[model samples]
Target: MPVASPIPLAPVPPMIGGGEMGDLVRDTDWSSTALGDYSSWPASLRTALSLVLNTKGIAALYWGPQQWLLYNDAYGLALGDRHPAAFGRPMPEVLTDIAPVLSPQVAQVLATGDGFSIENLSMMMRRHGKEEETVWTYSFSPVQGESGGYEGVLLLASEMTQQVLADRKRDRAEHERAQALLRLSELNAGLEEEISRRTADRNRLWLLSADIMLRCTFDGVITAVNPAWTDLLGWQESELIGLSLFELIHPDDLAHTQQGASLSADGHAYARFDNRYRHKDGSYRWISWSTQPDEQQINAVGRDFTAERESASALAAAEEALRQSQKLEAIGQLTGGVAHDFNNLLTVIKSSTDLLKRPDLSSERRARYVSAIADTVERAAKVTSQLLAFARRQTLQPTVFAPAENLRALASMIKTLVGAEVELAMDIPEHSHFVIADPSQFDMAIVNMAVNARDAMVGQGRLIIRVGPARRGSEANEQPMMPGDQVVISMTDTGSGIAPLHLGKIFEPFFTTKGVGQGTGLGLSQVFGFAKQSGGEITVDSEVDQGTTFTLYLPQASEPREPRSVEAPHELVHGHGTGVLIVEDNPQVGAFAMHSLTDLGYRPVLAINGQEALAELARDASRFKVVFSDVVLPGMTGIELAHEIRRRYAGLPVVLTSGYSHVLAEKGTDGFELLHKPYSVEQLSRLLCGAMCTHFSRVT
Candidate 1:
């Protein structure tokens, strides 16, 4: 039996090569565990352990009734911080955090001898320092006993904590994004409602507006119109929609309307103009329009102002009527002044004539009476000349003369008129100022102003006369001057100023503040008329009890050529049988003219009219040395007759006489000698002699 000593089998080698974990399994004390000793373990349990240990993925075995833990190297790492201590522990103690979830699956596998798997099972465990959430997929399989009863549970596991956490984070992001999209959708809906409301409001305004609002194309074709268009223009919208806007415009307004339309078409932002539009009843109404260009069309608003225009025209007519009434009043005053002044002159003449009629009158006494009559006649002629000047009817012989020189020449006369009581001062520029006006009238105007100043001063104030060049229409002028270079003649007086009430009427005929008989009321009026006729203006500035200044603006003229030297006055020459033709329409004037020419030593012929005179001349053209004709004739005018004579008888000279001839005033004497009416015998003689001399020279 000693020979029968049992041969001991070599210690059983580890069934798996799991590296470090396999070595740990060999070193582990399974004796204290429910699985007991490894050498004495059942084949079923041993085989299960071996299979789990050799598994490449994470795997573990729970053998025996206690279901103690036995794991491979891969399964050990899934334990985190509890690795080595949980290697051989009972499953309930080793995975206490997931025991409740894993116990049921393990029991089911053991009882049925079946295998099962769980995907993404969640659990809480203290694998590290503290308890944390974890996810895993697991497989459970029953290990069969040797005798065919289930022994314990086998497990395959994979940790899914990272994949599960990432999926959960992605799901949270998707949910928040969906909420933001919903809020955006709600805001868009509210914005859409606001836009609809505004559109409705604009439509209401378009329908309810009272003004005539219209839309037209750039070419002026009406595309749309509001109700006001019908109310104002009496045209239906349908009827006007396709019509050209220009067609409804009055003919006289078409050009302006077209111009405005063109400006709009050229991209002008806004335009305003007034034009007339034809109404349905065939009358035109004035329409003031304001338009704005937009895109390819024009938007316009129109208002009717016809009633306002009619009111303005009525006001103008009323003003003209008032002016005419005032003119009639001025004429009445003028006639009254003329009658009074003429009666005084006539009384003097009548007395002088009656005295001369006394047969016992001595030579010296007769001469004195005659002188009185002559003086009265001279006064009457002066009155007539002033009236003519005030009426702007006198024929003016305009010459270009320097105003400064003329004023200097008249200083002595002005001094005499103003009296020694008043001081006279002059401010005249050395540079010459020339004007084309009647030299005598200019002098008379200055004298009249001086007299007015003297009267205003009551013979004891200073008078300052200033002469300077000025520009017409300059801002410095108180009254508008004629458009040209002008010479300003200002007379400023330190005297009692004119009252505001009488200032406006000072230039009216027969309008004056002077005492009756002290003035004819024609002085300032003559100045006014002369200044106007010569293309000038006069202005007055005054303050009550202070002073007054009268400024006369006369158009300046270019310097004139030196005048011909005048021959000294000589004895009147006689015509000496020179043939003179007298053309007069009035019989008495014709006879008087014939006698006067005969007395002047000229052979005279008389004709009642221009036609008769022409006929007489045609009969014997060379028989007349000169033709003298009245300006106003029954047939051909003096100007027309003279034109004919010049063409027919080139060598003949003509002399015209007129008191007031429109032809002479407008057209002037056409290179012919003009003799004023009511001429003295010496004047007639001198003029006729000159005409005859000119005729003789031409013939020779």
Candidate 2:
């Protein structure tokens, strides 16, 4: 049992020199002050002042109900021009400039008979002769007097003005960066919309360019020239029209121009050819060009590069700009597709929420509506998780575990999900050794492949999950994975196989063969991404009327996995008034947890964020046996908090909960046990109790 240290009505240490403040304290006008004469001061005041004044820390003491102030030399400098004369004055007078910020803290320490701390406390005070912004990390504790009452507040503080300002600066910079990215994204999206809206107008915009733009027949007879031909080459639009394109090119540049034109002859096109065109004055001007062609005519756009001709860098830069434009066009197309999918999901969620608002709904209908909302939410989360995974933004937490054991464990669940008509087969060995991977993601990948297989079989066919070890294998899937000792798991379906035409697109996001509402097209892509991220590879094999199979090859771990301690599920213990800190940002979720914990005979503290939870624990860390926190929380994530707690309090266990988090998905949750969202009260209790019980036994 931890015992509280009593607040003594004495000095913090041995009585000694009071540093520079001692002379001023002795000479102060105490006769006209709250404590009468300085020499006749109470022993508690003298001892406390002496201890505080002698220390190097910025310490101070507020003595008596009047709160007489005293401080060391370190704190005296903080007083600016009022250092010496400020000694022994009532704290209220001395602290008049910062009273609003300091008073509540002092009152809190006195009211609770405990210490109060504020980090980066901001204040606008008359410091250095003007009102200025100041920040500090400060602490105040109640000091007991000779009569054992709350005498004053002991002050311990440090200025954090610079650090606070620096942090604000960084936050502003990050905000700006985010805004810039958002603007870029919006602009990219708008560009796509504009292009789609003006496809026909775009041809006119290109044809009437400031640089030369023209159309010609297959035999090179010029059909049209924009105003740019007249502006640059001193030729009327009518004069340029009906002439052969070869007549416009300078004699020395004709060969190169023909080479470019020849390439565009068979409905193929080429770009970045440099040549010269004849001006009306007979001089030649250099031009760099791009051409597009078809069976009837060829279209060309050119920009004058005469002045920049000596520098090849300019030509290269122009080519790069053209390439970038094409890339953005492709990206815009992808974004449009993603937006369509997301909007469909939002429609379902929005309609469900609006329906739930109707008070006349029946319980069964309400339940169905709620289930619809949950399903859509889960689907949305999975889609986002897969997107993050493909972008390599998800964190992976890898552990060494035998693939064979887990495959067997998931056999029943997989069978249930695939339905009764499908015959399930497992070819897993008793022990295929261990492999390193995120077990959760690995399980998800397996499930995704199995579901795809089940669907391919139309709910009625042979689905086989085979696990084994191999040194080398055929790369039927064409993925380039490292070749060495490996653990391979294959999910095979005995149904109509994928056609050759669809093979390349099977792993593309949003490319699904399932009917309109049946699939999200992220499953295979997620599997592919996960395999690649784990230093493994996934491949597919299929033939029409035959079967389809997805094989995942993972590098084998060098060491064997240690078996877990076996505990009977029925023997799980219950909490006996165990103190738990529940850190959840959602009020409904927090209230439910608190109520559930109370019913289970546990003392639960509800904190809406990681900071509040830390403050509660800091007050009396030993009172809490466990911390249950949402993975995504304000200020600090559950994963980060768990790390901090493990550092500060070794014996404490943290149970992190999340429905879906990019951080958790990318950076695997290790050390801390994860509790997925939508968990039951019974599940929470068992996890909390099991962790506490296991850790307690380990400590003993």
Candidate 3:
């Protein structure tokens, strides 16, 4: 029990004091413990006991047997409103809901006089019209009597539910975060592989590109170069690094190259430019350049134009030569036509002169004049033959033979023409390469080239003839000479090369550099005509003071062909059975042909023109075995007359002659054969016999 403080009381009133005099006076003994049953006890003693109970939170409980109890405002709140009258009720009634909850606790406290404690005790209890679930720390203590036996149990508790729930929610969130992290790791790996693959592809593309690519800074320092750049320039990375780009330009083009670069750096690009670049071997190449520039860098691509430049230069030269060739062709045509007519006139004049030289005239003076006329006629004939050869109008007997051997055969003749000072060098291979062309024409072509080379060298330089195969194009087609073979006859000279101006016209007739009498200017023209007719091409390479190389591309022959050799027959026997019809516009020409046929023992009927020939053929088509007609007549053409003849007598052998061979050559035909104008008496007879014999054989 605890002691209490004493309070001093005032004196009571006389009327109230007398009535309660038997119990106590106003100032009774306050130290006494007993009241009610004994008058000697003080009233102060009762008040003292009440104060001690209230101060210690201890209340007196009235129960039939021992049970649990609690003290203090905190313990009352734990029981809630259900235990409102707790001081004198039974413990089970006071805490009806807590009876089960405190049964074990009460029993333990009763057995042990010492207090007991329970940690994390949980319970669901009703409070404030709802069930509250709570976890708490709790303690239960036993109240002891004087003998120390258990009297009741005291309860104390504390709630702790919020902290545990918070930790579990945090754990779930961390697990999800870990899963997302794993997914992100996989995605990163795939991205790495994709990036690596793209890098390799870009690198390969850069290396294979044909155009050189360079990445450089604005200051003109090259930072990188593609494989094409390194391969084309023939320089390694180390050798090119830190070298000024101007050093790559040729000495003559250095200023222009710098100007172009400067312009590009100033944000203005020169889209196209041409300059010379020095090769690694010190040789120069023409380069055409195009550039694309941006704020930070410039990209340039250059194409090698050396070949194209040379071709352009060659084409310009060829055009000039074409002009000269056209001029020469005009002259040759005029001279040839005049010479052909003059030869006919001379033939008649010379025949008359020969008749005048008969034995009847014995004067020396008259005989000398006749002999002089004959000499003049012979000279005139030689001149016409030369003109015909130069005009490329003469016929040729072509055969397959090696040009190298042919040139060797003419070595002595070429030496005589050039003079002893010039050294002749032959680079012709020993292996036989055959070409189909006239042997005489082939010889003449080589001799003419050698003569030109000799003249260009001033009779004191090396002249070389090289023969080999040259590809005509991408196809493996052989070079064609007179339309067949693939070999080139190259004539190179050590003398001064042809001038750029004259190189093209070098093949034109009468276009000469030689003094008046030194050359007829017909050599190269004849060579050109022979090559063109043989379906060959001639290309010339000449540099001032270096030398001239003339390459002749000819069709290669499959096998060696025997040289063309013909022996004239001794007898001039006429064809008596070969009946021929002559078609002509001019009476003189017609008479000449008729008489020539008559002398040759051929029965020939004459017609004035194609109309007359057609009329004659229509009258008696069976009488003519062959019809020899001139094409360009006064009325219809020779072809029309032949068609008319064929319509009447389809089996009749018709031979057509023309002055313009191009007209017939342009037409494709297997049955039609053509003979050009100015045929001799023998040609006419032979052709007639050949046509009649062929027709008879076919009929048989």
**How high is each candidate's TM-score?**
0.63, 0.44, 0.43
Candidate 2 lDDT by residue in tens digits, 1-700: 1111233222233334776676555544555555665556667777778778777878998766666677899898887776666677776677688866676667666667788778887888676788888898878878877888777788988988889999999999999999999999999989988887798686678656698888998777999888888888999988877899898788888787777677678777866777888899998889887888877889888899888875787889989999999879757856876787789989998998899999999999899989998788787777776765565555667878888888888999899989999999999877566789878888988888888988899989999988877645454534344766678888889988999999988987767889887987878888888888788888788998899988898878977556677774333345678899999999999999999989888999999988888889899999999999998887788888888889888989888888768787666787677776667788898888778877877899
Ranking by lDDT: 1, 2, 3
User: How close to the true structure is residue 80 of candidate 2, measured as C-alpha lDDT?
Assistant: 79
lDDT of 3 by residue, 297-404 (tens): 777767777889999999999999999998788878657645655676577677767767677866875667677676666655444444455555544446678887
Q: Runs in model 2 with CA error above 4 Å?
A: 1-433, 438-444, 457-465, 471-479, 492-501, 542-547, 558-564, 568-578, 584-603, 606-612, 631-637, 660-667
| lDDT (10s digit) by residue, model 1, range 58-148 | 9998866667788898888888898877777778877888888877778778888889888998899887699988999988888788888
Q: Rate the local accuracy (lDDT) of all candidates.
A: 0.83, 0.80, 0.66
Candidate that scores best on lDDT? 1
Which structure is stronger by lDDT: 2 or 3?
2
Model 3 TM-score relative to the real fold: 0.43
Clashes of 3: 14
* Model 1 bad stretches (over 4 Å): 1-202, 216-221, 238-240, 243-284, 292-298, 347-370, 426-433, 468-484, 557-561, 566-573, 586-591, 607-612, 632-637, 694-700
- Which of candidates 2 and 3 is the stronger one according to TM-score? 2
